[model samples]
Target: MLLATSNHLGHDIRSEKYNVRGTKYRTKHFLEFCIFLFFIYEIEDNLIQNTR
Candidate 1:
């Protein structure tokens, strides 16, 4: 996948493939995307505790 920065804040990120499921994934930075993988699962682990 080619990651291109569309702006200075790295907010406008896009992938090469366009899924037809109507899911538009976006990210603020490439680094965030790297950590996002784990974050997807963290909701069940720490999200409940961190919500308070």
Candidate 2:
């Protein structure tokens, strides 16, 4: 019985670790996308200013 419980606990810990990693991966991608958008905005602003 104890062995079974330990096995279950191990599974839970592994899943939790995976969840944390997944969140980090998602956050990194999101930040990268935000940076890309900001870069585009800056380029557009510069173009508009040059045209003015």
Candidate 3:
């Protein structure tokens, strides 16, 4: 889910950046991406613990 969310967020960032509106959407997309990345890291940590 994290990977999928990252892909979606990347597409949103690209679309928002190219839009004629402004940087508002771009900033939102970037923040969302960061949050998703953190989620991915947490999942990885859990997986590592389970493997031990």
RMSD per candidate (Å) reads 14.8, 0.9, 17.1
Total clashes for model 2: 0
Distance from true location, Cα of 5 in model 3, Å? 46
The sequence of per-residue lDDT tens digits that candidate 1 reaches over residues 8-42 is 23542323234422344343455678788778778
Question: What global local distance difference test value does model 1 have?
Answer: 0.54
Q: Which stretches of candidate 3 lie over 4 Å from their true place?
A: 1-21
> What is the Cα-based lDDT of residue 42 in candidate 3?
100
* Candidate ranking (TM-score, best to worst): 2, 3, 1
lDDT of 2 at 41: 100
Ranking by lDDT: 2, 3, 1
Better TM-score candidate (2, 3): 2
Residue pairs in clash, model 3: none
- Candidate 2: which pairs clash? none
lDDT of 3 by residue, 1-52 (tens): 9999999999999887778455777888999999999999999999999999
TM-score of each: 0.22, 0.88, 0.57
After TM-score superposition, what is the CA distance of residue 31 in candidate 3 from its true location, in Å? 0.5
| Count of steric clashes across candidates, in order | 0, 0, 0
lDDT of each: 0.54, 1.00, 0.91
Once superposed on the true structure, which residue ranges of model 1 sit more than 4 Å away at CA? Answer: 1-28, 44-52
Any idea what lDDT model 2 has?
Answer: 1.00
Instruction: Flag clash pairs in model 1.
Output: none
